[model samples]
Target: MNPLGPGDPLRLGPYRLVAVLGDGGMGRVYLGRDGTGRAAAVKVLRRELAYDQNMAQRFVREAQVAQAVTSMGVARVLGAWYEGSWPWMATEFLAGPTLDQHIEEYGPFDDLGVRELGAALARALQDIHAAGLVHRDLKPSNIVMTSSGPRIIDFGIARPEHGLTLTLTGQIPVTPGYGAPEQVLGHRVGPPADVFSLGAVLVYAASGERAYDGGHVATVQYEVVHGEPNLSEVPEPIRVLVAPCLAKDPAHRPIPAQIAAACATSSGTKPSAKKIWQLGELAADIKQREAAAKQLISVPDVRTPSAPSRRRLITALAAGGGTVLAAGGGGLAWWLLSKDGGQGEARKPSEEESTAPPKPWDAKRLTASQYEDGTTPPSLWGPQEGPSPVVVQPLPVRDLVLVHDGGSTTLGAYNVIDGKRKWGTDVGSYARYVAPSDELVVTVGPVTVGRTGRLLALDSATGEKKWTAPADAVHVIAADAESVYFTARRDWRQSDVSLLGAFDMASRTTRWTVPMPVECTLVTPPEAATDSGRLVLCGQNGKVVALDTHTGKQVWTLPRQAVAILPIAPAVSKGIVYLGGKSLTARKLQSGEEIWSLPAKSEFKKTYGGWGAPVLDGDALYALDGEEISRRDRRDGKADWTRSLGDVLQQLDPPVVQGKTVWANVHSLDSGGIAVLHKDTGKPAWTYARDGSGGWGMAASGNRVFLVHGGKLTAMPVF
Candidate 1:
């Protein structure tokens, strides 16, 4: 606490200000008291900002935002002045230090302290989100260590523009490490964004270091978006838990309840307001301050401020989402949503309003997000039935993506850079194929709901539904700038036969659909067969076939040996189709003529439960076979080179080619790790291993390697 400065207020309404509690970008917090001697922490907005309509609007919404947060796991609001010369509000005084202060005073906490802290904070977040609020800034300073428990102070009530504010010293008013990628880009801020921060908070408590320490705001923001968080110093249980919370894709992070359960136990008693007072020398100092404050004020005179009870929220927000707030003693109500993706509404600055083109799609980020299946929540408009569970995975961006509420049960486009939402609709629980023109297909029915399958087309840019088609688990196989080709089972529940079709992306009208001659069970949509883009696709119909993408007419077909039942997606390069499961086969792309078939009995354990696709690199093809990476000839299926992993390898995931190297995830005996190899000679270049399980994955972008396996997308630096 600091002494009152020259411009400080002595009194505001019924409270007498004493000392400065803290300072922030928008306002100053003071230790104050009512006439009855009850102490309160009051916040006074900056005089200049109080007059600005935008600032005033945000300031007034504090009452509403605060009301949304339940009194559990946080300091309670005692009084508020909605209309005063200097807008001010008071909350219960917490007699303790902040997480930041405690960490600085003592050293870093042990694993037990970290776990307890995580539990308390996760519960706080659970209550906040239950109130339909996202605690945008959830850092150490915002958490006060009280005797009862850690109190989450200062809920994100102030909504500054794009979360970018220039301070008196020209530094930004935010901590970049605690903010997620979407927060930096000014995309949608959701509960998952808070979870990402939670991961950072846990890292700090355990190791006394920011996970992404770039020093400055710009560098930190860049690191949050591109670089992986360094968690080497973090030990086992905590490291394992913190990793998923910091996933690049929000969907992969476990929910708060899950977090609480996972980090449930603590060797020490849970952190509370009483703990600090009992253990440390500061107890005397805190007592002295409490007595001094009480001596200055009299007792038992004024009426206590009674906050209104939480009833049903009635305000309709801008994104057409349900917004139920108290509205400042029911003072004012407003709503927000992102045009690309987020809970907040899109509000561009004045200068770029007329000329800003659509935000570009971050292809790498999009590809990374594709594997996440973010199931929607029960409410998009307000808090969910049970603490209003929200699933804001696949964050959106402006003009380029469609935002959806966290766990929104809808089809939405999200921007890769900031997780801003473009548009969203009730298309279904999952999205399928992405077309060239930014239109994607999603499934309408899920088996859990016991509903038949149907397909819907949505504008990825707008989140608007274009058309609907009845189909059985349709999977996109091939796509171009104008159309999308797909394959589906004739009867999803019973038949092994399938059909192929072509549909114009814009109109969503089927050009044609044809039945397959062979009744194979496994299949995928059409793919480009030749270098010039002739349509070729594979199916368990026991064959690789070529079709005219425009007409859906089969050009040629070559059956796989009738013995192989499960066929993997074909890998096409030059003019060959490489598809197999327990067996490997090469066929002509244009005519579907057999080139070669590697028998199933070869010394390769490529498939475990599912077939592994071949990795194509110029002329050589690679596949994970048991304990080695085998490089085969693209033309004659002849062996080029093989590098034995020396230990039993996990099932192979699709491989990725970068320059002259190939990268993938593998498992050996007691560990899971990633390995990089020379594409031509099949010699090892680099490898990194840990104790956890890993999938064999193969996507790369920028300086990072993207792996999609086990239903998760992970980004790790090549280094």
Candidate 2:
């Protein structure tokens, strides 16, 4: 809590404000007391926004919603004045830390404690649902632990059951990793959505980690909508009780009633919240908070000179939970403030104006069936023939899979759903040169007899040219958010000299162009990958160079670490790049510092087989060496497990990890198709065998694996 500042109102209606609990963009929360000596957490609209009709109405709605819910698991509303020049609302002051704070201060709860917490939260949801409301945001930060039990707070985004989830232009509706799938998808939410949130909350309470987490917000939200809930750290008994509540489909989830019943004790009695809160370290913490609250409120007023500065005293008390009284109330009504300070309309994902392409097809989640052991999973779309074998995996962008048309020098976009051609344009290159940048596909046009090739950006959906760059490009190496890196001729006059160049996507101009090594030429364009701020270029003869993406300056280089006649794949993650060829190596992205290296093994002692590009998923790095596929730790080059194919494959293709299955292209004299291996054990699960094959080019997206072999293209479910 902080001392009252200039222009701070000492009182609101009957309550006299003492100290500030917290303040944010929307409003300020103050500790107040009434004539009867009753304490209340008073929330006032910011003076700058108080005059706005929408902001003022939100305060009224919050008060009404708070008062409508009749439950011991929430703070009771005291009084509200929305029509006044300064709108404010008061609620019963709550002491103790929030659920997230407690979880951080003390460890996760025991099994019994988790059950009691779940039961109380379930009942709270029951009350909130009965009032025809859905608590759109129910993360740990919105839950406060009082002496009585856990109390849900911050109803800022709460709306009627029919309400569509939406937020301001720059804000997300709910917290990442905790929001239910429907909420994350911007769908209309109901009581079952709250049940799903409860399941996630219980997971965190039991395991001390989020049920769904990722490096980015979009990634976490994607996991909630499509990925499975992570329950590996959760105890078995609790897992059985909570798993049903996290079902992706709202209809499949257990309701609050069912959750409450399942969490009951063996005696057929519901877990007691009071008993749970009155014991252990939690009880001690709560008692200390209550004592501090009593002592702070006992102070006569902020003007009492005899007392230490109320601001300093309350700020000190804050750490002990004394000033935690409705601290969440300050930023509670965030959605009320729009860019223009008017009521914002509901914005659904499908309705929003965005340039990002639609996510690729996810057939497995739609079908909801796991393939039986030893049985090949069915294809989601096709084995439709006509596309030539690809050097790179087919790119799934928007609704189409971009590939090189069969034996033609044109880029073809095929429908991801049914493997039908959508559009084809003469890109004058193979599939290896096409790169996706949101809705735009970047590629190089065919360089005619006397004219130089041009860089083009076509709409992923319509294949219409959107932007272009004048460069004598031979190959479209790769693209990141900022720029596209490619190998191009110096100019029409110096057409014989090959140069490495970057084209800024935003500015639509040449960023920087630098001469490539004498070994790198136009005929054999290097295989390049860009990420973070570095561009990794690997030559066909195994020369590797790293250049700063911002400026075309070379950062580091590796001198023929690989002895492959083919392009060695360089995969980047975090700050390290994993390369495969003569040896599987992990090196620092900025400098050529070696992190770890593993020698490739072969049946013949005199020969060293090349390793495929390393594929990274979580902590595991997977690559194929000769006939053996190995899964090793990404941090160190130590192998976790390995599986060998009796017959060698056509090429050293990296294994693709999707869901729980690792899909690898297998081609031998006797069998040729896709090989499915268990991600954890590296044991063969099933194989889809195809007769007469030139090996398969594979890519996994939206829970489906896309394979391009010979003139055939197919999409299979991940199982």
Candidate 3:
């Protein structure tokens, strides 16, 4: 039975409980107030849990650590004591929803929002790390979006540097999905692990998708250790940031300072001292709205006509008074003259002042052709133009590209550079996946439940479908300039039979189909083309088999822990294939020999897959994590420079990179307006409101930004 109810009070030391806020796995959180009615959140441990000596000691230690930390982003512990059979701790009551609740209610946050959250949390972590503490449970549920800023809660799972283990038998200290690989394996974890968990939390907050997902706990754990994170919906610019945080090895993960700096650089927005003030104002506004709603409901209506009886009496009195007034006018005039000696003088207006005309609420509209033509001469590759499409809205600037999940059966494409209609073609029953190549577009469609697949090759410049094939029997893993390679499953009924195959693009012929072990799932296809004459396959059980692309012959097989195989296209400049899953491993295409394995930082806990497939621009490999995007040395994965984009924002679209400018579109929770940011340095370039219609999606190309609201589309110039 619950002991607390609305308006019920229970005294505990210096505070009196007003009501129960919530109950979690560990204890009950209460809304409490002191004698003077100052409110606080009181956490009371469960009787069974409190009875354990080790757990009780840990609880006290957490309280002490929390009290010692002075960061406003962390909840400050105010009091602690044991009452009756329960141990309790008190902290200042924060009036806001949990990060999880906020995301669920409002969807994912935008780029600006993500940046704000990332920076604030980074600062919070800095304090924690400085104090030699690791907040192992740094999930969204433990973070409160308080009026002042994000306040991290739940120190119960926090681990200090010196005193780490504080657990009872049969009590597993774990936060599934958010836990790092080390934590899942029951290995001793440190601050780096917390950073990894933080990345996972940010990914969830930003994309509303779990980085590692499976039907069961064991499967999820397996995927966390070996599978690539499903980041299909995550924005591209931010995707790079989330990658390193999900690195399997903790040592390779980035520190808090690096994370903070990276985020600042990514969003070009730095955390300011006024964040707390803004947070407070936000909280106040929420409270005000709630109060107004209550007041409106409680007010009574008063609308009734007055009685007619008084009307007749007043009319007769008025008739008699009129005659009297005519006679008494001379007397009344003398009385008025006595009452007032003179009238007041009026003031003159200033010379410069004049009545101004009201401003007109006019909006500019650009047609598809006008938008496209605007990008023609000077900006050759700008977005496309057409009757504004109902799908993903295109942005100004040629580099911005749109990858859309077409309705029902078709996958659509619009060039962001000039708002030009690139292509809209039907692939299958449902086009679930779409990926871009320099010269080709790869689209995957699920035709049926467990028995269908279709892979369509489309001309990049035009919307013409180059070829369509039955992909259900074969996994169309990846493609390149030369050919497409796929892994085929034979007796899927046995759960283990599969084969690997390759198709020559020019000849339009199947080159080879090599048999493989049973129950094998194809990782990402090899990055190199079939013309490179090599194929790589990683099985569900962790066997990596290399094959000759032209002939069905095995080249070599390497054993690894069953993990997701992230296929990298053979580097065009460097000629190395980068495969990353639980760990980042670079292998030679011809020899299949190991090149190098850079250990992930110890703090990273979850894998949202490779952030951006080891983007190789030159000698540098660009990577993304929860906190920031980093450029690392391609040869040894050495850090060069890092930039941070704050926490994940709700309703955020993936970022698009143009020449030197990276653009991200974000929508606010309070007002559904669109905010565009320069991706390189997370700075706001422009913010436009859509009033009540609400923005659905946006894309950039050339000079125009195409916005979609319901069925209506509007185009705005990038400059």
Candidate 4:
């Protein structure tokens, strides 16, 4: 379980939630206390599920069965609140390691251990079946090992075997690799299905991985229905007992009672419950962590006589009333002041900020190599493997082109002039966004499952570790010489609110955190709109706001628009912020007034890479619409020259404009290359052809163009 983050609820229903136990797509599990001082685990369902009538009904019915089970091997459900706006259930809290975590950490169980575990599970399932319900979703994670024995939990998909099914064929929810063929085929499931699941579970306990490949759902279903089960590593006696339980036909599978008897008969002396702790230290670690986190939180005294009044206060607090439970007291305690309280009137955008000198396009200058054909600077690195390749737009600092290799999990500085790696550091073993500045290189990777990602800073020249701090969940929106900006949520697609913050490296804290007025639930962080040292934030449904980075204050904001404005990075040049989204927009940096805006000419492909940010050059603003790049007068948005690369370069990097020449990187493998266009006419001045191996986005300094293609960094001269 992760420590409770800011804004996580402290109380729900009649229970005072103390610590987060786990979180899943369905909801959150929190350790809590009831009004009687009894401890329990409370599960709060996702709000979106409230709108699904069918799902809500199933949830309530399942909760009843969960609370009704009397088996010692099952965690008892205590209470549930289904009719309220937030649906939650309280169950007897179990402190132990999940079977999944245990097996993952300690490897597979021995043959004797497997038989013992199988016997315990068989008896548990038999009891559940006697209750007339089928635990349709039984996986390793659902089984908790206590000092006494294995206990089943999470009856989310459980239902009476004879009851009319709420889910239809192919729609029934079951964890793949554990579900029976009948469940996968969406046929009516019964106790025999549990037997099949048990067989699969035992197979996993004896061997580390699952019986059927779980890479693809459809493939897994097909295999579960027809393919032979994988038991190559299973030892003899337990293997003999498991083979018959996984029979293709449910009727052929042994009953739980018979299976248990057979396993026990052949099994040696049963292992003691005290030895269960030997599964690994995972459970112990969780308890230790939970104890530490609880030290900072004020848990509500649910057993107090005034509990009803306190709960009402908490309900009100959720609506912004600001009540807080006092530590060590059973009575109502502190009231947190509202953020709006005492804050003076909101600041208005001033004309000075709007009329400030339009900033020039600020980017690294790459000296295009003049070395002819031999100048295809040698690649600093070689090929690596992984489905996710680096999103190349080489960041050049001095003579080094900073690049990341996701396949190799390395971040390095390559000499732009020599193409030799100067220095490299292991960033991590996952996809990360690398942002470069004059002094530091910052990289943010995906959230580490239960924990947030770290913002790692490396010295620009040495590639040596500078500092490490917590970062927004996935990606960096923008980075400057002082701080890194990012969106807070782990997955943009799963969040309603994204926290936008600036982390100050020196202070090791957030300079400021403001909730973006948009829903950007994509995997990566939404790009920030910036110009002239000010940040113009884009939100879905037409919300755009500008902030002054120096004082961490809002400058101006725009009203809602008809379209979502979750932009790529907004470009600022000549005092105007050019925003990209479903449409292109130009707004005054100071006053948040729209200079001009245009809807996309056509839909772009669904890929994560370059945002369609407008490119600013001299008096013109260049923006992408479909496959075309159009230029307009920056002053009045008057039309200028427009060009199309036919059907090529759909994933475009922002074009770099210098004097009368323009350079843009093309993303392609077979035909991808650089195209140079005349600034005056929307026609190509010349083109540099590559075997589609050149990276997207070329860095220009003086007359040199630096590009990273196919994991190699190179520099070439702009003729």
Candidate 5:
């Protein structure tokens, strides 16, 4: 929870506002209390949004829709006042994590647990439908797993069964992947649409994967409208019950009553709601949040009979890690805010802040056409003499960009704000092989006659040695918060197979070591990626292997996953690893199960060329295929838009994403420049044309793109 800032109202009707539970584009949710000390989650329309007729209507409609439904399976609305200075609505505060959070933190539920969850949600839908309303959005995030059971929340889009789908201009009618086929097409929807969402939710609960997914929003929506649901990982018993709810035709889908009956426990009876939520890791987490919420609201009686001071409230919030028990109906802001807030310090706002939203910054001063027409925006700072012409990718660490020219054994740091040199170090190591670990930079020192390769670290700011480990590392792969992963060889010249190992950052020791899979022969140095406790080794021989980072146990392996000649750089995110080759594919990081794959060859037999490594930003995957730079859906690898670059060298280098531009290096016979495309529409934004190119690289940080070409480094503005 955040402390109230300047211009924030102290009270709303009879409820005295305390800390801010959450805030979003539309409004803010606050923790409030009445004279009797009854806690509530009060939602108020944003001042700017209140002035918007459409937004104001939507806010009032949410209150009306949420209030119409009365059931034990839904959060209860306490009161609402739309015609007032600050339009607000209050609902009973819930103290448990949403179903989405539970599934993410604790893993997918067991079969029985999924059954209970589905049954409860189905019954909730029955009540909502009975009230002649349809819960348009019923994804996992909207359902709170309270101690009692799963309670449906969020009615911001709920409407009468007869109402047509309507949203703000440019807004998708429903969630991309979870919405039913009818909803995805913007067709009229009814209770069956909610059932389809329930089925999607159950699929997520039963298996930690989405029912329909893609790299981009359009791809997911396309799948929802035209493709089959992915229920391959779901257990047979659960699949049978949930499949009917996801029928493409609404009339063919099961009703809420039927779904509840089919999803009941094996004993042919409804499971105990309380018992389900009071067991396992999920229960423990929910209990902690509930306890924290109670402590946050526990105010003492004083002689002055006044509300608690801001300092005292902040103290209480700090002790509870700022966990807010918010009304599920209006808690989207809280959910987004608390996403990363659980692990570290709570964010305390300043005593005053402007009520207006932050202003958007310009992406770039010059457009792609403008640059081609001989116009240039002054460089943020650079064209400074760099350390070397043959440089690897520049690593940005805090206020500096670290450069390691492959030709030199020295590493150089330049201030990002200005192109001034900060420091330089000579560490008897291959300058190109380096990875950043917080304040220290990890690198591989050259092997000596008496010893194998050694791991070394240097202070990023001062160029001072921090620590060294005789771990026999040959190349740095990647680094996470805890450890730095690398490939090593006992005898660098003798071994064709590299050993994978990790260096513990905190203890400054080698954590574990294991041989690379025999099939993964490193003809060339391999590329690696790490995420979700798995380190993926992508070899040049088309063999990919995932190993448990902690134990070095092989989790899964894929043979001939990509072409053998070029090293494949795997991109990992959200527990999925993406590989680009004959077919750009997404697979579960831990299990190596394919989520979606897009073939390189089109139906017309036209070759788009094999995709280069892909760079993912939010929902889009950008990669160069032959002469064309395409933005494809990460979920399904379907190209949303593509721009053809007449003739360019197709290196393994993935596109770089900064601000609103997708930057790609196009090395043509003449003087190739970086192609700047609008991230969303793939429109040509601008080109950073250069005069000459032997080899060049680009890295972006702090709204600036660092370019290295012609033996000089320059910083360019970005959208």
Candidate 6:
């Protein structure tokens, strides 16, 4: 069964074995050729490991998750399948070497190379963590050096902790020296644990030594638990950063994103004057020395001094010098003449050239006047007509505010920063949902007539009534600068059906309504109207429908399964819609086509199902499920970073990012408190606790954050 021996069949599956790359605790890895003759390193599970059901399941799951993560720095998972009794996973076979092998053959890396390696590994960890899986086993042996950069391999043991436990009584099996204390104790393990391992790996890679210098496993574990790491060789700037990553308590450890940012800041090389001067001088010296050496080596004869010979040499030298001088003068003249023959010539600027004045600052500062009018309007009011609320709610605007208090309806102009009372009218009691638009706020409630709901339009500023209508089922409301759309559902004796309808804001007319094939929930509005003049809608049943806003015609429909859907409103940035649930997907608004999708962490499969829509900012989409918030690329759904906020209080508010900080209203499960985070690094900025009480439903603006509790609002500064 060994593929490395001579005369044995080198090919397995689509790859041909070339040589034994190495052997590890799991099995032997073979260098092999693919169907196209490209090289790959395939790790085949040992028979002992493969036969163990638990280990095999973990291996297969790791392979599945590893394949879902897409990053050039991480070794690409090419294929995984059973070949006899062994299961194997193949990755791009790099020709360089393992970090371990490199260190063994060449000692430790230089400071610059070590920092570069740290940054690359940190980035790779970011990608892996973003996919919701932890590289539980990160060491020098798992990192492969390549021409491009480091490639992280061996996800055979990586696993999500969603439904899994760290240890059963004392069955801890992780590498003793690299494992965090919580991991050692077999308690809960999260991304922080992986960060601890990464810190140990970096230390080993930089110093060519283990974090602990003990001889016994117990001694190493003791050192890891109680002793400071031997980081004498690590650069000063990185020492402080890596220290936190090795914290014994997972809660005290820095997240992978923070580690990466720190590594980036420390490792960014800048050219210096001394280095530049040295390089220039070295180049000049090398050129002069080479010329002198070449002349000496090329000459074949040497002559002793003689009067007649010297005179003849002098005469010959004088004639040669005159010829050389004339040629140089003529070439210079010709170059000068050629400059004037160009199509156009630029004139020198005058000494008194006027410089443009500095451009005016465009960013608006937060003014006290914005929040000074602390007057609270009554819950019920008639329309009075004024300017609508400004349309800025992060980006990829999703969600409209509509309130059905009892049956008496109140329509509010909703935005990320402010929500204003637009209008209030007596509809009925027992309202369920409210959907908002620039000009109208629709209030819906369940009724006997197939879950009937009511829709109303009001003057955005004055709260004056515009028009009203009855709807079947109301789940969401989407709007542009000019019009509004809503999704409604109707239930028959045995089946439930859904519909999407659009209404003109100026005319107060039902523009159109189209029936849906199945009962579905609306994710968000399209980023732009399609060529067919219709808005796009994603349903809960995984169908994307484009319906004409002016007519009841179906423009196009496609099948898609998303855990979450967030519509991008026109008032915000356009051309992109955010989706997250089980998996994250971004779609182009114009064509109802998927742009990209990223795998969501298994832990988020449940909590994120009920979390708010993903928030979009520029090209980044932010989504939080439970204690983790991930920033992903809006174009290709690639993860930029993932940060764990830790489990806090119940009924926690969503996270808001401002400047370099992320503010959130958290309630501690043990007690009531609030936790704040640095957005760029995911490190805890601060934590504030309310006396004897818990808070919920928080909102933030500028440097201040607000929390509503028992009919009272508490505002606190973030800094």
TM-scores for candidates 1 onward, in order: 0.38, 0.51, 0.39, 0.41, 0.57, 0.36
lDDT of 4 by residue, 1-719 (tens): 23355656677777777655555556667667766766667777666775776777676667777565778877776777674566777776654456775564344565556777888888988888888888776678778766567777766556888654544345547777788898877688889988998898988887766788857887887888999888876757667888888888999999999988986784443333333333223334334323322322334433345443433433322222122212110111122222232133212111112212323322233235422332333322232221125554566676666666445466666665556668866654443444545677777643445566667777887877787787544556676544567666534345443667777655777777776645564343455644344666655444566775544567676554324333455676434677665566776565556668776665544442223666765446766655666777765666677788655554434676654456665544467766667666776756655566535545665345665556555555443
Error at 242, model 3, angstroms: 2.0
Writing each residue's lDDT as its tens digit, candidate 3 over 49-90 gives: 889876776786676676766788787677777666767777
Using TM-score as the measure, name the better of candidate 1 and candidate 4: 4
Q: How well is each residue in 1-719 modelled by candidate 2, as lDDT tens digits?
A: 55678778888899988877667545788888999888878888777777778767766675666577778876666677874577887777776777886665444665667888898999999998888888877878778888888988765456777765424457787888888898888777788888888999999987777999999999999999999999987877789988998999899998888888888754332233246567544675677667666766787777657766744564344334222444434433111112222235221111111112335454534233566768886777778876866544688885678777776577888887888899988876562455545588888876666777789888888989987778788777788655777777766556364788888776778888998752555445676776545788887667788886766778788877666555666887544788988788988665657879988785322223668777877557889888888888877788889998667643555788876678776777766877888878898888877775565788776666788876788887764
Candidate 4 stretches greater than 4 Å from native: 1-388, 406-408, 428-437, 445-451, 490-497, 538-545, 548-567, 581-583, 598-611, 649-652, 658-660, 665-671, 691-695
lDDT of 5 at 618: 53
> Where does candidate 6 stray beyond 4 Å?
1-454, 470-476, 489-497, 517-560, 563-573, 604-612, 636-640, 648-655, 658-661, 664-675, 687-719
TM-score: model 4 vs. ground truth: 0.41
Better of 1 and 6 by lDDT: 1
- What lDDT does the true structure give each of the candidates? 0.54, 0.72, 0.52, 0.60, 0.72, 0.49
Question: At residue 645, what lDDT does model 5 achieve?
Answer: 72
Winning model by TM-score: 5
- Kindly provide the TM-score of model 2 when superposed on the true structure, using C-alpha atoms: 0.51
Candidate 3 Cα misplacement greater than 4 A, ranges: 1-9, 164-172, 266-719
Question: What's the distance in Å from true for residue 307, model 3?
Answer: 41
In lDDT terms, how accurate is model 2? 0.72
Please give the lDDT score for candidate 5: 0.72
Answer with 1 or 2, whichever has the higher TM-score. Answer: 2
After aligning candidate 3 to the native by TM-score, how far in Å is the CA of 540 from where it should be? 51
